[model samples]
Target: MIGFKLLHEKNHSSATHKGTGAWFGSKPINVDIGQNPVFLLRAPDGSVGAAISSNDSANAYKQALITLVKNTLDRFSRGGFSAASLEAAMLGGAENARWKWDRMLEIVRNDFTNIKKFDEGGLYYRIIHFDPKSGLAAVSRKKANPDDWNPASAKLSIESGTKGFSEGHAGGVVANATRFFREKTTFTALREVVIPAHLAETPDAPFLFWSAACSAGAEAYSYAMYIHRLLTRAKATCPFKVFATDINQKLVEGAKTGVYKANKNDIGEYRAYFRRYGELDGDTVRFGKEIRQFISFNTFDLKQRPRKKGFRMVVCANVFQYYDDAARSHFLENFMSAVTRPGYIFVGPMRDPIIHALGLKKLTKYKMFMVE
Candidate 1:
């Protein structure tokens, strides 16, 4: 109570809202509201911090939910936290908004089903003290806390509202996207896994990465942006290129144009990268020469072997789940032969079991499996 700051609900009629000052610091903060909810978040590293939400509005829960999710994702990318590595604890929904809150919780659960810990359902007035930098928090009931607050400002809605959180978005923010909507991916593994692994073992020249199932080129472009950010931040312009291939020739042709439709969530999750590497024209996202130079799109079936060898990384996040074990093994064998030793192979969860079943060992320090 002494150090924790209070946050207010947004008022649709007014353009102003409180709590920006409170959210600026690393100290614990509390939200003052009636029957809405709060979300506390933590990065998997145990130092990313926490959150809680409370607002006043009879029908604004859905609006608030989308806003919070988008903002949380923006912060996550800036902090270098992956969706798989992000954790969340939700609190503060009362019986008054059970039905609405239940739907919101479903979205959160789908995104973070494997959370560090989950706690919810506090009906009465309560206070939460949360640290965002270290993810430390304490929750307690208050004897005389005020829960009545009116909407004091305007409601903010980004393009797409709740539509961005589709099943394809995958809330994991950490999952690998392969142009497949159901599997959302992010700036994952690149900073914490791919770049580090390359620097550690194979700092070879002309570092090559493979996007085995590039779809419409979203995955390839994402990889290109990720690689550029890492290399740029390091101040090392090492020669590197991404070889993107998909069986679909039409998709490959479309990829050469380097444009895609980004929903509100895509824009949110990829806000930082898009700003630096691409252009946003309303809902359309287009990448220019800077990012395009690092990647080449082509048509190649996973069942066949690539003539080129010594690729430093391979990301085939799709097509595996649809294949039989034999087909999976064949594709794996072909791609594995193409990668360099001490390199990496990133697959999706659907393909994870086949990988383990084939006895392909995963590196202890990274999400990718070794090339050799």
Candidate 2:
């Protein structure tokens, strides 16, 4: 069932500063995805202003609305539609409308389970229903379970293959890095930036690389392999540590072990890099003396502030898109605070605005912004 609600009165106060459009007079229209569609329109006052029950309504109308949304999205692209126009046009056709939250909740509860309120310390918390596939739906707070308050479990599904993890975007980061840096900058230049001269000086000074949102461990391992090759080439006498983290602990653990199903395209360079650094032992890729001394792995959330600092470089690639503007800014500020001066920050492609807005200079190499 689709559900929409206006920003709660409490949320309105925060939304203004958070840059949420719902508090800026933009109403939210939620459309549910299922065999039968259900739509709810919520006002700015956190009240359900209109409802369209496609399960009981005419199939033709539901199909028509679905077609309209699809066509509109296709024509204008995802960000092109005006919410007001779409809401006005869609709700104009509703009949026998009702405004009963209790009844609506009752009807939806019939087949849904684990319905509860999910709060991530934000203004956008909602009541959800837990489904097998899409997982959980946000429900009102009163119906939520206190024991199920953990956001990590709520966010990730039990299945593997990066279904619920941030791997897809992390993979996109690798692709973008390949495009922006690999093609544009030489491997020698990348080695210099990533494995900087200062880091090489203190090769055993417990250097840590945190991939804050490492998905399926590809990027983290890629980094580990890169460092291994650098130290091996230099014939360094010390080891460096690399830590891969994710909100999902399972993926983080997987990364620590360094075992993965290798796709030829994705794992090729990583394998070659590993060959230079150390040896691949069974499923796990182990680092040698030069790289192993500096790398470690752990689970971390970007939203949370890191307890320690003095990291030489932090690779927070491509994780910012998951956050809204305010959250992004807060995390970036925290990142700035964590890295020591002359330390490097590697952000994803889409994060130029936040990166540049903070007055961080992009390291230039051959006229390209190169961050290791």
Candidate 3:
């Protein structure tokens, strides 16, 4: 866990903005992984134990499960037996049987019985790994890939292991997401903005984009507005698609509705988002069909299986700082895999190091990157 912190903080160019005023539990609502991703570990009485991973996803349920299993096994083995020995004995065979690991995963799977599915509009949480050999479990707030899951249950026992986006930290990144496009400096904007413009200009090309963790569709709509502007100026008739996804069903629906209840600070930006795409009726802002037509909103979990089609651009901004390095790598791999060779990925400014580490070339001084 300590080592991963070093890795996550590796390319963080800015000082870790020392947060003040009761930082703990101060997470803002409607932000990814800020409050909703919950874990319900089943207790012996057939009841469930639930907790939210408000600070970091990695430390939430993964660590809790490890501790729960370890304590349970320690009590079981107090007659004097190693955790591994107890696990092996409970499985009625050697470690090769994989019974010990399977049981632990089963406990986790059972807890999800009440949770909803992506298709059924279920809750989204990622079970990164359920390793019996290492006695470690990793669950976080991303979508899960069904193909990667192993249904078999395991005997509970102690195991050792090491383990986003809202408000102060998230606010900074969200500001960056909107700010990146507003830069008027030609030197910076020309290089950064031209790429998207160019992509939309390709004759008859279907300009497809995916914005992960798109809260209430603001950022995704921003991209649509940009594409609309570029294509309109170029007189291009290229078909385009913007797939905006979030784990929350309510947020997805709200994004689809394209209605935003704007605060005082957001009035200007909300008005901008309404330009050519939305309308402002006093304090209420509603998006028009013109821009909304280009975008499709879905309840998606990035940790689950990815989309089958490739995209020209992928924007996962203002949300990367919440996870550890491993989850960060998962996000990059998913993004890179989902796009074509000559594609681009736009993340928050803080993720520059992780992007560089992945061998992507930086486009702007801020957060955009291109596959080299």
lDDT to native, each model: 0.58, 0.42, 0.46
lDDT by residue for model 1 over 27-51, one digit each (tens)?
Answer: 4454443334556666655555545
Candidate 3: misplaced stretches above 4 Å? 1-202, 269-275, 350-357
The sequence of per-residue lDDT tens digits that candidate 3 reaches over residues 1-372 is 000011122232331112110111111111112212222222222121222222212213345555554554444445444333322111111121122223334444442333321111122322221223332223233232222121111111111000022221222323123331332232243235644555544667787778777767776776777777766776777787889987667667867888776666667654565655678788777878888899999987666568655677787754443444455566777888887666777654424355667888776554466664
Poorest 10 consecutive residues by lDDT, candidate 2: 15-24
- How does residue 37 of candidate 2 score in lDDT? 22
Q: Estimate each model's TM-score.
A: 0.50, 0.45, 0.49
Question: Could you tell me how far off, in angstroms, the CA of residue 233 lies in candidate 1 after the best superposition?
Answer: 1.2
Q: TM-score of model 3 relative to the true fold?
A: 0.49
Better of 1 and 2 by lDDT: 1
Q: Give the per-residue lDDT of model 2 (tens digit) for 183-286.
A: 22323444766466546456566555555566556666566656656766777766466666667676666656644455455345456665665576544455
Q: Which stretches of candidate 2 lie over 4 Å from their true place?
A: 1-190, 197-206, 235-239, 267-271, 274-294, 350-353, 364-372
